[model samples]
Target chain A: MMDRMAVTTTTRVAELHELLARHETSPAAGNVPVHPELVELFPRGLRTGAVYSLHGSMSAALALLAGPSAAGSWCAVVGVPDLGIEAAADWGVWLDRIALIPRVPAGEWTSVVAALVEVSALVVAAPPEHISPGEVSRLLARLRTSGSTLVVLGNWPRAVATLTGQVTRWDGLYDGHGHLRGGSLRLEVTERQRTRYADLELPVRP
Target chain B: MISAAPIRVLLLWCPGWPVLAARLVQGIAADRALALTDRGVVVACSPAAQAEGVAVGLRVRQAQHRCPDLVVLPHDVAAETRAFEPVLRAIEEKIPDVHVVRPGLAAVKARGAGRFYGSEEAAAHALLTHLQRFTADELRLPVDLRMAVADGLFTAEHAAYSSSARQPLVVVPTGRSRDFLAGLPVSVACDRRLANLLQRMGIRTLGDLAKLPRAQVNSRFGAPGLRAHQLASGEDSPILRPRVVPPELGLHVAFDPPAAQIEQIVLRCEPAAEGFVQLLTRSALICTEIRVTVQLEPDALFERLWRHPWQFGKTEVLDRIRWQLEDLATEAVTTDDETLGASVLSVQVLPESVDNAEHHAQGLWGDRPDEKVEHALTTLQHRLGHESVLTSTVAGGRLLHERRVLRPWGDALPTLRERRLEQPWPGTVPGPSPATVFSSASQVQVLSADGAPITVDERGTVNERPTWLRTHEGQRRIEQWAGPWPIRQRWWRKVKQLNRFQLVDNHLTAWLLLSDGAVWFTEARYD
Candidate 1:
């Protein structure tokens, strides 16, 4: 049942580690906490073709749009019905990024992104219906390896999987921000390659 | 002469019971009302045949003896309050500054009303119309409603009680309220006991009360009488208070033709829910409970409660909603039962909060599995209703039957015991498990017959050593077999639990095998 899937996913991580080591990502060879091979995820703060938990994915996109400015961009947002965007705005990201979209039915939503895709680096799209595994596989295979990021949000997906080399799963909070609030994320990455390394949990900047 | 905005007053009484001048006054509906006897009616305007010098308060027989044409109206308290609503509404509309004196009286700042709504006469006409409409709408009043819009609440109130011939509306010129009361009788005010006491003191007119030393009247009449005096003299100070209203918010979507299909309904509602989320976003609140209400037919409405919360996004919301619609669509519909119709009438989001953050407070952020597990369970429940699906584990007993159970989650399982998984795990069941599990639905076929293995009757009877026979799709033979292990529970109960087991499926897809010494059963499958 579901137990098999969990076992399969766990086994895949070991397979991914083998692939990373094959790619020359050696633990003793690299100085940083993350394997040298996966450091490529943030090349100048651009989220290069990686899977992210919705909010974490959004943070990466916000990091890109805000540039080097300590105080990020301001926004006038709309249409992000289910997302509590204020959670991000508090981290010093300005609100000019917000815009309200009128009602968009679930079935007719993918095409709605054509206009938003060009201007906004990160357009939070709540797909109208469940995206099939075939659809997800199709989307992953079609990626041109460009620098753009898309964050798909939900209450919880029954299971998550994609056909990609790097599988960066979110394990949760990073230490030392504050007692009650303030901290970043601890993302455990499984780089599926044949050469060097994979399967490691590391805290990146918030 | 008055130079500033004139004061406005409205007096109204709904209805009570009748006893005295006080009772009649108490029973009046308009901001003000008067209890008039046949004799009082006669004294005011009736022909000499009706009046014949009959004074107020005389019995009907005495009035009839005094004047044969006197007309009488039995007291009506509720009718009076109903009658007053229109006048209250009218005066409220024309001169917002008015104060209600009681069931029968009202007053307005005359100078402003006269200038704005056009002369005092026009304003009074407007007030009368407003009251008349109220009477028609609320009281079903048959009587032609009447009222006087004057300089003071007292004058307007008296005017309301007066016959149409007596001028229902009169303008007491600026600074004239006091002057207008000069000839009025002392008993016209509500304090009849005080009025009678004053009358015993030889003061029968308003002028007589005003004529008494202010100090003497203050000492003799007490505060109620003093208030009554102030009212009679048109000098009462009004203290206005506003009414409190309840706080409730709802978001509704109306489609052009109404949708019956769940997908179509979800399409319209996701955005509406988004809109609902947006409206309440500024309030620093989150909802864990939502009741889905659907109006299928013009006459039929269906509603169910969704008690679940998300740690993050709206995915769980959309999934459960869609799955619920799917489950509903699969129902065994009858001729009378309407399939979901077209046009989703509305989706209402109930406000529930897991966090009571102030407007500026931040929600607790961290990786939380409970919110995650809850989201999954809710999605399953919405797609399955309360009965069909379950997460079953063997517990709470020593016997095989008693050892089986279903624990609750956000999904519908039998019970919920709040357990913490933050610490090192101990008692959880081992994994690498079966894919599909069952509880009460599928029955087992036993194959224990005479010369061979026991076979189950299609009706489930078995006298021989039973062999497991379960049917779903097709009959596939047992590939490999595992256990006849025993489970016993509920030693406290007279009927203890005794469950025997075996795993029989050729492909290594595990299926739970069992028998109660007497009968065998199939419990689950590894999908």
Candidate 2:
């Protein structure tokens, strides 16, 4: 009876260890992959059917997109003409799989965004200036039904989460001689009126 | 005894067909001097060009020098084949079993046609008359058509080449091809190396090569030489594989009263589109390229060629038609051509190229996981335009804006040349590249400590240290900055000289600044 109890206990312990490892590694249901350096802010990874409003850092937004894009999911950018492809590539986003919708007339902006939401696994759009609440709701409903994520470049009302990062100190620059190599960023994440802070490095990888 | 008989072939040859096709299709005047060049060498020249001493084997520059009015055109193989299709159709009316040797050359089994028309000469005459009438009626060209009947295709082709314009039909008597080919040079076998070798061996003519022992010749030169020797001896073997003519699968839809709206035409043509795809599927084929011709009322015809990366489906076909119709509508509005209020009378969809269905067949597990994504993107494209939905790739360029190449959905992705990308561009801004690259750089004022505008001198030295950056947004203090890397490019043509700088302001935003020796501009932003 003692031997049997010991075997059972060891087996139970192994099972519990495996479950813990999987919980830590695997993305939760309705969540997509996020960069390892960004996991502190997005603990459950980027949630599906949710809007993430990103401000102050386009590189951070591209970094967020790089995760799912590198994982071979189709991502799109709408109305952000200046979104640098080279930067997106440097941030680890697969340049070929990403679609860019640079310009859309104000009248057809929401419709175009909704159409992209239906197709892409994730869409990054800069919401136009004159978008109404109704249009936003309609787009959110489409996003919910399609189970795709949206990352807005600027302000988005009632977003599920908001990310703001500021460059604290740039590395490899001494005012004149050397180039701007990388930098440090003070990243802040706010969800449900609760805020979390993380200190990260730009270009998480060398 | 029957094995000793050589197969009879009737060959149709059109000299200078490339120039003739260019004239017929491109509407180049026949009286004008025209030469078709392939790889900088004149392959064919029209008679008018020949009158000015231009000929095949002449360099393009030499030909142009000889004939100052020479119109040089690159040889277009596809256009040549397209122009030859109607001629093949016209000949197929007389002989069903015709084999195309190339665009300008074709052959048919002379025995059947000869027996049907009572004699080889009668059959040749009959074909010549029919072709004459067909060319005059349809192409409206005085096509120099030559026909010859002889034992085997090689002898028949040589006979056709030898025939003059006056006597366009040359019929070599049966069993006499040996004598007919004896005087011809050994180069007629179309093997340049072997001909040269044979000439070096003092065998200059086909009769000289034929005089050698067959077994010795085979032992000397192997398979190709043996084949050439057989051609020289006029023992031509039967080897023509006649083309199995494909059935016409082009779809044609006609509106009785002419459809006004683009949507209405697309709606009415939905059944035809389905039928076209289904017909291709039934034949185990898929069309990759299609030529769409839209005929509008009041005698206006608009045609366009569309290509698909994959096989065209019904939905894709309908989308292409709708897009083309929308383009037509817009063009009508802009050009104010009589087509402004004209209705679409008919639309024809013809497959320009096709592939076997097995190449595109789905696997058991299914192919293309992004079919739904493609469908949705195509829907958006229809709502907006083809250029609105784009996929991008990083191309090799020093300029940030030039590095990104965007293509529409379903368009071929630009291939990245690794060697070019691996180039050491001296003055490009070092990565990590800025995230947002402005298409047009906005002007900025980089001010020194005393607020005077900073500048770079001709000796590549900064006039002052920049402390504040002023822009349309607002003025901000430059917390960190980098040097002005000079870029001098294209000095020979249009000189582009600029100095680039990287600056980080107090707001934690990074800016890529450029100056053309005078004013500063923000080229990109790391926002």
Candidate 3:
């Protein structure tokens, strides 16, 4: 029953997006750009005032934030205390403009995220373990009012889209003797609202 | 030619100030015999104590003998100075340009204030009335406050002291300062040693000192005598200059019911914070350092000085208030019953240091994005407690984790990192740096092709090449690998050593592996 409700809500959200798309302006004002390789997954890139859920890979979730961050938008990582700072920097996210709030007390999680959305262009957070659907909807409302995007690292009940990636192949190795370099990831993007799906192979840099 | 006479100055002298300040802090009655003792000797004594035969130079035991009921308190100069700050601030409230001659006394130019208040006499009365009300109401003590106006600070101070208890204020006419000083003893012009010498030289009164030839006085008593003789002749020294008072830029809010909730307190202070920022903005100034003082129930106070790399705005001010309140709340909840674990009575924000905002304006293109980012970060910090939001900067350290330091937003970035980054660090991990460093290293098993565990030798060399890696996540094939970089740290003491290796699995994910001769662990990942 919950799944069905989520699906209907997703469809309603998609219809809302389609209506918005018809009135959308040029790329400069509509959505933030992403890496070219992942363009097939998000053809028009990540939209402002939207939330995306990324599963199975922390690196990919951080990658989604790097593009907007590099474009001079301030980004914050909330509730991920163990996130690797070096990895975020390696992904081309500007470290100076990035704030890390590794922990938010259970009661203050909503307030903290709302505050971050007001000032930050992008907020990547790991939803707290026991957040209710109502809280998610309220946070989404806040994000919309502030015109900031939220990238959730785990399952979000009504996320606009969910992007999941699995490692597909390893490169830069010679008979298990050479230094470990980089690899490729098979990314599967599911747009919840439109019930659309896309797949692509994206390069992963170390 | 008469050198321009010292501008008329008013001195507010609190007699036996050290004792008064001590009594003010202790809440002791003025009628009680109290003496502030320094090094076991009385430095200052109250009037009631003085009448009981307690004098400044008397030993504590002797003073106790003279007045059995005398309260002997140790002289705390710092406490006296701290207690006197509010008194100076109070005087400054009415008279703008008051300068502290010392903790006990303050001087201000009376000429301008006199004209503004209609007359010098009226001005003195107004000042005395204000101080009297302040002492009786704010300090809740009956102190003998005296004020006097004259040509020079020294004479003015003396006049205040010499004035009878019935009429505490003495305002000498402009040209009568010379006449007022004529009959005063020479001890008023110089220290004890010089006063003794002047008495021996027959200069008993200031008039007698003024009678000596200037060059003779300079030669006999040196510079001190010349300065004294000039002062005795009613010539003003160059010391009394009116101080330039900085604008008072502090806003305060009182909670009617006294609030314990941090959010409620912050909300109440929001309007005042906005007004404060707007006030500074209108003056083209910005505050770099602010003092947030929280008054708790029953007189407990919590105050902290916060500094910012850039000028603070309303958001930053609110963040500081919330941070301070949160800290106070936590302290109250965790501490003993003796701590003041009560609601906040009031909050005061005082801008300690300010700079011209024009100097900090963004360049021609206007850095709007940076401003927005700062505002957002500051707002976030206010919402999630100050410690939750942080920016990482490099610092001096031998280890990777130690080298990276996190500072709260709006704080000055650590400068130690830049200098530390230049130093040669042997045994440091070679980069391309790891994409993600684990907060703590996780144990992993590196197995040979036959599934036997690979171990490092005493010389930091691996016994066999690992073909498989087993972690909490599960096992995977090792596709590429490098290094057994050896690092023996603190060899002289516990003699701990480690061998590090870079490993890549079939999925191309890289891990930094470490072995302490017995076991292997994954310390970081290159995602």
Candidate 4:
């Protein structure tokens, strides 16, 4: 009976360590605030020093930028030549504090982004056509040291979370009739190997 | 405050100095009809131009019509100041404490010079002789100079202006300045509106203005009028504070055999940059702007003024030099000038503006947090060209592309001419703004349900409803569609009539498409 109890106790200790490990590695406990609507997905807000990959939607990426930007944090957008500033402003971004670098040459992409990560609270960029893993790690090191979050428009390897969104339903448009007023966005959020789903409206109302 | 006995001042005046400076710097003949214009209005004119009725305050076209052969040049203040520097230096050799009133005028106290020379009149003549010799012998451009010595700066300046070419020096006897200035017009007080008001009040001459009771003048005309009254009555005790000559802070770096690469020049300038900052620190000042003058071998000279948001450090100075060299290198490829491709011989770094260190002191708490971000942006600007890093403002326009205005970081945003965001730009795409706006529109094929090309008419009617959108990726069936919102702009100049459409495809993503009657283009995406 003592041997069986010891075995059970050992399993209990192992389970507790596993829980502690997950908590320690997860960035969900970070302090940077997200939008109130996004609180369900990010319980503790956006994690500083964490890389978040976005897929199939630029508006979703802009929605992420709008939160910290409205909260008076400086944000930078690099390599997104056609980023809509009006849409960002519509989503409640403070345009005055945002830096928009439309293009960084392929060769200077890593260094430029690394330098930018040192100062801004959040950096949004489209990953260049080709980037080495070594350069990515160097940039990630800077992000960790500076406590700045990196939001990638395209896929980024080793991102802490990946956000994929699609326009599931669009409102206020018909066959040769009304204009595009608002729409519904279906979001698939994956963090720490777990996936969750969310549905929200475009141009999130104040 | 007016003292009982106003100190004596000697004034030197040069009329039409802008025209003379143009002649000296631009090689324009001063004897010909010449006028200097600022913003299309004549600011100054030469004797020949004045004889042709081309005077100050005349528009450029009017002056040109009056003279017919008038040589009009844009007034450049820097060139005027640069050409006047040697003349000021020449006078400084004779008068130890000369105060420059303007580029063309200077003032000095007459008491010390009078004591050194026999009399105030002799001191004035000695100063004039010294300037004439310097201009005639050294500069080779002899100027028509005038001098006056009187009880106060206002009367001394007026006396110098009133002196003729024949009698270039005018001296008012002590305590007789009021009598000397009595015959001059009230406009000599240098207040145009006040002079116009006084003229309407029948105070045409300085003597008429001086005859008014002082208390009455104070009560009726206010402070400026009372000061004008004091000037007319010779009670203007103007303070003549001598200007300290600026120390030599400019650095010259010469690369022997010339620098072939920008990095080489930047490397060589490291020590010079350190020394430049040290020089400013020693003077208890900081440089905020610098003029980098680069000289290329065989004769191409280029200079650009670089302004820093904060005081320039050694690294910033070096970065500016590197950026300038890189800019010159790029210009060489586009321009046909072979001299620009030649090696760079030397560079001159001159401080354009310097401020006291006390004004730039750090706060008691710490530096503002925006500085780190600002510095980072500046670093990015150095790596990329100045126009690469930008801050955007949502300006007013019908199209998505035209609505957002991008300004280079650290540059002053141009005033929104008429495109203010508050204006109700009618017929714009309604509702939520698109997320991705193409910098330049990309062509797309829009077809009807019957697989025929779609077009819009001038009357804002679509020939057929667009049911399919064909991009480079593939064709997508339209789920819903709207808009033939006609955008007509600049109809009198280049008439642009465009019909816009909003289409939601099978994937549920919306696209903002524009049709210029025949061709269709995707302007933005709601994704």
**C-alpha lDDT of all candidate models, in order:** 0.42, 0.82, 0.76, 0.83
Lowest lDDT sum, 10 consecutive residues, model 4 chain A, at A20-29
For model 1, the local distance difference test gives: 0.42
Interface RMSD of each: 24.4, 13.6, 14.1, 16.4
Could you give the interface RMSD of candidate 1 in angstroms?
24.4
lDDT of 1 at B323: 54
Q: Which order, best to worst by DockQ?
A: 4, 2, 3, 1
Candidate 3, residue B491: the lDDT equals 25
Best by lDDT: 4
Candidate 3: tens digits of C-alpha lDDT, residues B1-527: 23647778888988778888988789888799999888999989998998999999999999999999999888998899888887888898888867888888899889889999999999999999999999889887777888999987877877888887689999888877777888999998988999998888787999888877999999988988888887887777536654434556888999889877777788999999999998776566668899999998888889999988777888789978877877776677645432336888999999988976545453212322344566667666656557767887555544555555677877766665563767877766654555466666678999999999998778766677789999989999987787677766642124378777787787667787877777877777765
- Model 2: clashing residue pairs? A58-B527
Question: How well docked is model 3, in DockQ terms?
Answer: 0.16
Stretches of candidate 1 exceeding 4 Å from the true structure: A1-206, B1-108, B122-149, B182-205, B219-222, B238-252, B261-294, B298-527
Better model by DockQ, 1 or 4?
Answer: 4
Best by DockQ: 4
Residue lDDT tens for model 1, A40-152: 44333324233333332333323323332122211211133322222233233333333223235454343333333322334445454565665554444332132233444
- Sort by lDDT, top down from the best: 4, 2, 3, 1
TM-scores of chain B, in order: 0.37, 0.73, 0.49, 0.78
Query: On residues B1-527, what C-alpha lDDT tens digit does candidate 4 reach at each position?
Result: 77757789988998878888898998876589989999999999998998989889999999999999999889998899888888888878988777888888888999999998889989999999999999899878869999999998888889988899999999998899889989999998748998999999999999999999989999988998888888899987767878667779988999898876777788888999899998777666668789999999888888998876457888888877877887787777745322346689999899999976545554211222355677789878977988899988888888788888898776534456644878888867888999999997788999999999998878888888788899999999998998888887642124478788898999988999888887888889999
